[model samples]
Target chain A: MTSQSAAVLKKKSDRKKMGMKARENVYQGILWIFLIVLALTMILPFLYVVILSFTDSTAYQAGKLILWPEKWSTEAYQLILSGDGFMNALKSTLFITVIGTPLSVIINAGLAYMLSKPIPGKGFFNKYVMFTMLFSAGMVPNFMNIKQLGLIDNYFAMILPSLCGAWTIMVMRSFFQSLPVDLEEAAKIDGCGPLKIFARIVIPLSKPMLATMTLFAFVSYWNMYFNCVMYITSTAKQTLQVYVQKVVLSSTVSDVVDLSMDLATTVPQEVMRMAAVVVVVLPILIIYPFLQKYFQSGMMVGAVKG
Target chain B: MAKKKVKYKATNKTLRQQIYEFRWIYFLGIPGLIILLLMNYMPMRNLIMAFQDYNPHLGILKSPWVGLEHFQTLFQDDKFYNMLKNTLIISGLSLLTFPAPVILALIMNEVRNAKFKKFIQTSVYLPHFLSWAIVASLTFFLLSTEQGFVNKVAEMMGNEPTAYLFSSKWIYVIIVVQSLWKSVGWGSIVYLAAIAGIDQSLYEAAKMDGANRFQCMWKITLPSIMPTVMVMLILRMGTIISVDFEQVFLMNNAMVKQQLEVFEVYIYNNSIASGSTQYSYTTAIGIFKSVINTGLVLLTNWITNRKGYEGVM
Candidate 1:
């Protein structure tokens, strides 16, 4: 009787273990499917943009939203790049990004580095900087100030107001503080002044951080639109975002349509709009690999506890 | 005793010499300070334009202050409540989505495959770096009546195409979904970091006690990241009033203009539309928005503290 009971008990425990393994497999299956679907949702939109831009009218009509292009063509790209609209916007964006990024990095790094030191009035100055992050001067007032400063219709208007954001300064300061105290002391004993220490020791040690900041600042400047719209009134000075937006949006074409009408009208407008978007953002994709590598590390650095 | 005396003398000398030695650092900081003064602090005093009939010709110095005049205008305007409603709905819907990142992070943590996890992260984060213009344009292609993929799909299916953009029904959904698409992966970064910081030994103990993987995730991992989740939720309350001006402005068209008008856009429209802005009135609206946002943040922070979570402030 005891042997029979033990056999039944053993069978019950075996079945329970099997059930647990089965449930685990089910959970794993669902989790994998969910993640893959989420990733596709992110990726497919971009792929669709690229494919639609390259796909000719015949392929697109056949609903060729496949992973690879069929009836692939460069007509849309040629049409977009051929236009004066794209070129002018490209120039304006280049000017904004190229000039704005280095200036932002240098000024922010300078202020942040100094503020990181044990200087007189450090607390007051740090708080003064932090206050700007919390309280802003409002849109109308800021516009009025820009007008008063005679920056209307000027490119500097786009660059100057955004130069020293309080968040960047704070993050940069924390990075500076995290550096070894011994490195700075050693530099001092070697008879290096503040400028020398900054230019030589600090800049070299934090090359990766600086590179990340530069790329981030570059992306932000490249993507700048609100200031561009507010400050730049002329069509000639309009940045890529505003320009691309005008072409892509509006079911009925705006007058800029004439500027972009170099291509045959037979080409689908969707292709043209998609091409315009892809062309404008192509730089981002090219640098995407580098951005992916550094951005995560840079974000982790910024996450250091205050 | 002698060493202590030497240290005291060294301090007295170092105080004056340190300031003198670091003059370049002080000098280096001047340009940033000037820019800060010019850009941030300089415009702040103009906030008083809320009270006055601000005239550009006479400027802030000469505009006569009519106390509470603009405030009265703001309260009485029909557009005010509409803008308020849009703000609440957009922000409220977004608040409903705040847990999305935490959920994503938790699920991601369960994945033992590092390569697959990285691929998922890199793909989803692609949208975050793109400008609002690009995203809006994407929306135009996918949802716009003329060239949208949705309309095309509908037409092929022998159904009438929906004008998603021209209707108010899809406005909140469009805005919030786009925001989530753009930010959900980016937002998960914080929570993923929080999860990484959780003590691994707790999971081991749970496993020893015969807990299943799912149970360990819920009972150990979720509880460990609660403080971060609470702090983030509290901080998110502060942004309820300040909807993305860029998003709303880019998305605005003639059909749904009334439905989409938020405070910042309204201020922008009032300034640039007729070419003669009621600066004081807009400034009053700005101040009102800021005050409410500040209040919301403080209230949420206080509540979080009372609940014994970490304080955001």
Candidate 2:
């Protein structure tokens, strides 16, 4: 009787373990399914934009929406690229990104280095700086200030106003503070003056922060539609975002159809708009992955420690 | 005694050595100070425009002092109330749901497969890079009445599709969701980094004690990252009044303006809109907004600190 009871207990325990393992397997399956669906939802809209970019205008107007192009055509690209607006916007965006980013990195880095040091009255200076960041003069006052500076309608209106971003300086300062003090001390011991130490040792070591700040600056200046809309009344200086805005906000589908004489206009304004979206953002999406390898490390440096 | 002598020698360096020792420090400070003065501090004096009846022809100080007349005008305007209401609502929603990124990071941390995890992160973050103009356009494509994706899906499921943008009731939802879509991924980065920094040995110890993955996360991972979440939350509360002006301005139209007009837009439109450049009035509105924002930051910081979390203070 004792042997029989022991066998039954052993069997019961084995069955329970099997059941738990099976439940665990089911749970894992459910989790995977959820993640996959979430990822698909995230990617599908962007994919649809790309698909719409290649769809023919006539079918697009007819409301033939599909995950794939119904009839293929690059006429939208042709129209967008040939237009004077597109070329001018592209030039303006490129100019801003190329010029503005480096300037921000240098200025922010230099400021961060100085602020990172523990010196006399550093607290006062730091408070003065962070004050502008936390409490702004708001939009109108800043606009009036720009107007008073006689910066309107000039490229400097865009570049100069945003040159010294306080957030970037703060981020860089935090990053600089986190660096080991030994590096600076060792450089000092090597008969390195503060300038030489800063230029040769500090800047080289802070490359990741520099890269991250550069990316931040580039993205910001590229996406600057509000500033352009406010200060740039000139059509010649409109950026890509402004050009895309004009296209999207242009007269409705019927208005476009009425204005154009061409039969079955090869590209629908809707499709053209999607194509424009693809064109405008494609550079960053393409460039970011390459930059990501660098960006990941840079973000790690700022983020992980904090 | 020897160490004291060395310290004295260092302190008593010649004038040339003293200048050379501190020269790079000054070098770093000067250029940065100049740029800061130009870009930040200089424009700050224009806050004087708030006090005067700022007239372009008369110049800033040359204009007569209006004292609190502009502020009185601002408080009297009914639209001012609406702007303040809208600003508070939008910011409140953001603050309430700000922990979403932390939640998302926790979920991402659980995924075992590195490749799939990366794919999820990249897709989630892609929207952040899109400009507000682009996002607004995309929203129009997906949510518009005639040919939008959501409407089409609704039709297939046998429901009548409503125009999401035109309805005043739906405008706030649109703003909040768009904001979430754009920021959720980027926002997760800080928490994810915090999670990654958790000591591996803690998790191994949990496993040894027969703790499951869920238990391990609840006990170990969450607490480890709580400090990071608290810091982010404090920073968020400090700017709870300031909404992102670009997205709201770009997405709004006549039908939704009443519901969607935020403080930033209220200030920006007064100055930038054609035939509506009321300089003194806008400046006063700006000053009012700044004072309120500053007060809120300090108050929130004090409250959080008293409650025992490490806030911005």
Highest TM-score model number: 1
Q: Supply the TM-score for candidate 2.
A: 0.89
lDDT tens readout by residue for model 2, A1-306: 999999999999899889878877886677668777866766787788888888876555544346666678888777777666677889998888888888878877887788898544466778877876667777776777678788888777788777786677787887788888898899888888877888888888888677766776888888879889888888889888988887777765323222233432456677777877888888878767755655245454353323
- Can you tell me the DockQ of model 2? 0.49
The residue ranges of model 1 lying beyond 4 angstroms of the native Cα positions read A1-23, A57-70, A251-264, A295-306, B1-10, B13-18, B295-313
lDDT of 2: 0.77
Question: lDDT tens string, model 1, A1-306?
Answer: 999999999999999989987987888778889999999988777778888788876666533223456689998777777777778888888998999999999999999998999775677889889878777878887887888899998888999998888888888887898999898899899998889989999989878777777887888889989998888899888999998898886453324544555445666777888888898888988877887776456444353222
Itemize residue pairs with steric clashes in candidate 2.
A57-A267, A57-A268
Alpha-carbon shift of residue A294 in model 1 (angstroms) = 3.8
Residue B249 alpha-carbon offset, candidate 1, angstroms: 1.2
* lDDT for residue B125 in candidate 2, whole number 0-100: 74
The interface RMSD value for candidate 2 stands at 2.9
Q: DockQ for each of the predicted structures, in order? A: 0.52, 0.49
Model 1 DockQ, alpha carbons vs. true complex: 0.52
